[model samples]
Target: MAAAVASLYRRVLPSPPAVDFASPEGKRLFAEALAAGTMEGFFPLVSCFQTQSEPAFCGLASLAVVLNALSIDPGRRWKGPWRWFDESMLDCCEPLDKVKAEGITFGKVACLARCSGANVQSFRANLATIDDLRRHLVRCVSSQDCHLIASYHRQAFKQTGTGHFSPIGGYHAGQDMALILDVARFKYPPHWVPLRLLWDAMNMTDDSTGLLRGFMLISRKTAAPSSLYTVSCRDENWKSMAKYCVEDLPNLLKGDNLDNVQTLLSRLIESLPAEAEALIKWVVEVRRKEEGDPSLSKEEKERLFLKENVLQQVRDTRLFAIVHDLQYANNPCCNCSSSSEEDSLTRIAAAVCCQGAAMLSGNLASRHGFCCKETCLKCIQANGDGLKTVISASVVSEGNEHGVDMLLPMSSPGASSCNSNLKNNVVKYPSSADVLTVLLLALHPSTWLGIKDEKLKAELQTLVSTDNLPDDLKREIMHLRRQLYYLKTCKEKEEYEDDDLPSPKWLG
Candidate 1:
């Protein structure tokens, strides 16, 4: 009876058309690639290959395998004090529940990689030719330091699914074939696919992103901290906190009564814990450029220290004062104090910066627009002079065409001051966050007190009124609000309430 059952199952099971990696033909394909020295990337991938934990975890599993293969630090504690990349830890871009309901997009996967400390360059199929993909595959497969993940329509290969993600393990130059270390092991085995066929599959559109599915080349990030104002991307309450910034904040600051605003801000500040502080310590690299090389120049070792000092001075003079002022706003008796105006100003600035950064940083980056820490720091520093110049000019209404700048800088005396190169690279148009930051900073009661020119004060007030806002500013606000709703729907954490427990009865 068992023999009959085995024979019946064998007869009924259907075989896949693609050449299986463990099959005889597949072995020959790999052997040929190996003999041709085109399989250098295979060993590392094969050793670290993993299957998807859930039906929709192909992207996460594939990313985990590549991350581990590159030996990038996961940063958070995994099981038993081990810091490793797993499917469960790849939640930086979207919530796991949403990912389970609907798999992630190629852009989101790249976003997750960037947030998890990996460098990624993603390519969409509709944007590039088949030769372009061929070149990337050859380069990735011939190099062990980097890896490739393909997001394709499985139906293109006559497979049993729609969209799928898998790491490419090897390439056969002569056959023009690539080896897919499929993460969905239960549905499909590892197989060799024709390069053209794979490209065609990837060239199809992903319904989720309305973009063509494609590939991502991932590598490890090895750079120092970038900015003095890095945000807390790991904060779980950032979602709720950000909603308060865009929604409840306008209503809170609606009136012109200084004391009322100050009192409200003070109460809000006191209600939150110190852990709610958003801006973290900005660290600069102080170590020698190269160890055991006494000949290493002093210039090399001191590269970032000067920049760090410049940034710290700017942050303190511009943003930190606001943070310090808001922290002490809870004292009602201080409303009539000498620093009352300053405190009111700082409270508004600090609250806006904290929540603004949370909203901006929480959004996933675009596919090809991954900004590293070094780049972020450079952008902040480079924009410093332009931002300061604009603020000094006191023409906030000029922000129609060129959006308002945010990060402010202090006057520096010597060579440690901001460089001319930084001044030359001022971003033409600031983001919506920068514009909003400028508007919030303009709301400082101290700003109004110092401004004797009614025109300047009126221009500042124009920024706060929704009806008087420029079309561009209105569009940016609407765009941010839409993105907030989309993100909340996709990444919001689910909450559940505990039910009452039944009482136990004892009979003696």
Candidate 2:
């Protein structure tokens, strides 16, 4: 049985035009390219070459090699005492089991890369010229700083398979050839194909996306991936959550007292999976206090520092206070005007803008906030109770630079779709910043301020005092206090600047 199985493995797929790297002609071409100094990508790619875990995982395998070669930290533990990229961990966009069975497409591959924190430039063959592709191929193969992945029809090279993905290991400018570092090492060796031929292969349409197959230029992001939160790249579930935030959540806030709003906040927090809730709490309460031991190695210290810096940025956003302001915007006694539904919607829009922007680390307000605001106002006016389902918001931009879209399904007011059922499938967790947002809002001064109930105010004050609060919560509150003070001073300075009087140096 062993002999027969080995015999089956020995058979090579029918690839005609491609020259196997081990063959004499292929070796000659490679040596010539090396001597000509065109093999820049070869060394890095060869060092990180990987075999696909499954036949349909060529994209995943190719991506892992580039990610590792770029030295990007995976953020999550790959094994004890280490973090690395592997095929199994590339499920930020699609499930591993699904990718193992059905393979992945160019867009999804790009989505995964974006979520994983790479700076990716994707080009569809139909939209790009052959000359344009040649320029990219030459630039990638001549540099170790970036890498390229070719998504092409395997049969275009006379291979037996259909769609496939592999990294371009080198480019021979004089000969106009590209060295393909095939990920499916079980069937094929690294092969050389003419650059134009590779272009022809990529120009074919992908049935899954109904777009031409393409190539992606991937490199390490200037900033590392966030250690605190990640976007759920799943389309439908993200939409449902966004719709909930834009429509349902604000509706729940209307005319409700602090007690009811607190209950609602708890309900939303409870909606998260146990794993997600635990992760958020651990990051907030535990990780914040972890000033890594100076006794550890330099690399460990750098990782710890990166984690601390990102978390500090989250803290600096004062997201919790913003969320608190939104929740209390509709209070009967608050200064917010809601005499007309239009006014109410406008306030909701502003709150949503602040909440979404804060959750997104301000990217949403600059890029997509106006669109979301306009959509909400129009939907409320045109539809009322029949408000259309929002396809997405900035939930996916939590730690993402490109702000990938995540979709969610909308249910009726009482029938929420944002629940733990989304765990490990469509969503990861609510943004840690969002969880912190609600957590901090609970301690906001407005929650207890102007209250007639002396007993309730005293109880809340007691809960917020340093003696009653946990160390981590206390630190967070202090951070919020400092941040709010800074904002107040800045606003005052701006007001003074607007007048004829010189701005105060003390404020500065």
Global lDDT of each candidate: 0.53, 0.55
**Model 2 steric clash total:** 10
Per-residue lDDT of candidate 1, residues 1-508 (tens digit): 3454432111111234468888899999999999887788888887888889888989999999999998886643343324567787777567677788898877778767665666667777766778988888888889888899999998777876799999998889888999999998877788898888899998888887667888888887664222222223344565555555444454444434334333534444444433443322222121111121222234322333343343433322222223334532333344334355344334433433322222232322121132111101112223222212111111111121111112322223232224332232222222112332322432322333333345544654443333443333333233233223333333432110001111112100
| Candidate with best TM-score | 2
Per-model RMSD to reference: 18.2, 19.8
- Candidate 2, residue 492: the lDDT equals 32
TM-score of each: 0.52, 0.57
How well is each residue in 182-273 modelled by candidate 2, as lDDT tens digits? 99988788999988889999988887766788888988876545443344422235334434433444444342354533454454544443
